[model samples]
Target: MTSDEEAFRRMVRGSEAAFAELFDRHSGAVYRYSWGLAESRDEVADIVQETFLVLWRRRKEIRLAGHSVLPWLLVCCRNTAYNHNRARRRSPAGELTEPKPGTHAWHRRVEQEQAVEELAWVREEIAALPDTERRLCDLCLIEGLSYDEAASALGISPSAARKRIQRARGKLRAAKTANL
Candidate 1:
């Protein structure tokens, strides 16, 4: 195998140095994917870490078919961000979710105000969900877990998780349209 491929294999074998090298190689691409999903730097950081964590956990299954690991990492980053967004929406007190801009503090407070207002609306909508449906949203959308992962987390089957998410989404859609 090529040197890069060899490195990938080493990474899969759970070498911390190998993992660090892999992280250095793919972090930029993963960050870009995360940024595309949400402008928040904090969110991007979380997604990157989560993606790498999953990769580390499933290293044996990962194959270095190409010279790059960008594609796999990007997919993981997207899913991670999706899960993060979903989880934020399920908070009980209906907290506002904003991507922490981190170093991008140049924007005016007016922009912050606008984002806060939008977040409030989102929180209210989520708060309107019934308990079961809200939990479904939490497991399915937040925490970046797959249907299986979410199901496992909630102690339900994957099929049940899928069904509950569908039903909850339908209610959310109906309620949203009612407001229009």
Candidate 2:
């Protein structure tokens, strides 16, 4: 192994100085990777911090693996960014423009009200779905399973899983069009 790889292994085993060396050697590459995805400095910084935090938490497993760290780090960054985006989407402020300091509080309140109403409508629509379709959606989409995986989990065949997902999607699209 190269000296840098050896140092990274040490760092993952909790060597503070080795961790510093690892950071110095790779933080620029990580930051650039985050910047490419997030575009916002704050979000990029969050992704970097999350990536390292996860690395530290999983250090033991990391030390056992003989693969290059860069690809693992990149995947970690991407996962972190995706998770952050999903969380931000769930926030009330996510859909609205950043409020100016001088903007009226009432205007912000109105925006929040509209967002809540939209969320309620979405919830109702989802709740209105047939139980089978709803369950399929929960397994395949929310749980992030492939059709084959979802089928195994749901005790169905892969073709059945695919058909269920397609039917569910069609139902949702029809509901959306009807609502519009």
The lDDT values for all models are 0.72, 0.74
TM-score of each: 0.47, 0.47
lDDT at 15, model 1: 53
Query: Mind giving the per-residue lDDT tens digits that candidate 2 earns over 10-121?
Result: 7666665555556667788999998888745668888998898887788778643454577778888988888887776777354546556667976887789989988777
Cα-lDDT of candidate 1 = 0.72
Candidate 1: residue 156 Cα off by (Å) = 56
Number of the predicted model whose lDDT against the real structure is largest:
2
Which residue pairs overlap in candidate 1's backbone? 83-144, 87-142
Candidate 2, residue 49: lDDT: 84
Question: After superposing candidate 1, which stretches have Cα over 4 Å from the reference?
Answer: 1-3, 39-41, 92-180
- Distance (Å) between predicted and true CA of 51, model 2? 0.6
C-alpha lDDT of residue 83 in model 2: 83
- Candidate 1 lDDT, 1-180, residue by residue in tens: 235566677677655555766777778888778888854555777888889999889889887567777677877788889888777667534565655555355345558887988677765776678776666665455434578887786788889888988877787778668867
